[model samples]
Target: MKVNKDLTATASANLILDELYTNTGSSSFNLEHDFFYGGAELEIWTMANQAGILLTEDTDYTLSDIDDTLTNQASRNVYKAVTIDNVTYQSDDIYFSYQACADFVDADDRYMVTREDGQYWDLNSSGGFDLVVSDDITFKDQYLASAIPLSESGTTGLEGF
Candidate 1:
């Protein structure tokens, strides 16, 4: 299955999840497809962007749900400003580079569980990856909205997607 990263992160993530579920018989764990694409991936993008890190196609990082992790060892530059719960924390404080931090946030399994209404948190404290909340689920909504114009009424009109 091919996925376009340019599309909102959730759609892209769903494509990945679909491919994985088809090939590996994996379950989405009650999380929406948008959780991976928009929530996890976008968190990486936002954190990287906030650190003044530009994710170039080759120089940046890539996300994989097969093993479920985000990695960018290209430059290994550490970040200093990372805000969590409105409190800023430094990557140096945790001795993790910005990319590593993003990877941890995106890939860690504990963060995937539903904690409350619209909230998912890290239940593991072993690695100290810091607590993060999932955000930006609109990508899936936008994809669904985009489908309205193409849907025919009966046959699955999810052709171009």
Candidate 2:
């Protein structure tokens, strides 16, 4: 008889390793982070040295949760698709770098709060968002890194990496 076991770890790891190398010539990886930086800002390397060409989003690999701008990213996914040449096999190691809310106590990481209609709040003494509420962001989209592609023009989000 087989006995099922309850998971001691219920949530996904803040920093996880997903091995993409395979003998079947294809692989898929899942990244479930609430504050995932998103695909447009994500940088994925298919090689160990990270010196060769970078894979293009939607063309080489498909990133899930492309619809809404909601805060919940538990449904997000990243799939390294199969190519004509089986691109995944070219390298024995795959690397990726991204920012996410890994920890809540770390001040370097941003915080999330609940919002509802008919609610109001004011910025804290430092002009930062309040834990209870926040005013509508009046800053231009160009000034926001999350809204704009921080990479150089004509580059496919692979500039710094």
Q: Root-mean-square deviation of each candidate, in angstroms? A: 17.7, 17.9
- All models: lDDT? 0.26, 0.35
Per residue, candidate 2 scores C-alpha lDDT tens digits across 91-142 of: 4454555434322122222222213353333323233334432332222222
lDDT tens per residue, model 1, 68-89: 2221321222221222221122
After best superposition, candidate 1 residue 5: deviation in angstroms?
13
Off by over 4 Å in 2: 1-27, 32-35, 65-91, 101-161
Best by lDDT: 2
In candidate 1, stretches whose alpha carbon ends up further than 4 angstroms from where it belongs are 1-72, 82-103, 107-111, 116-118, 123-126, 129-161
TM-score of each candidate structure, all chains considered together: 0.18, 0.32
Clashes of 2: 0
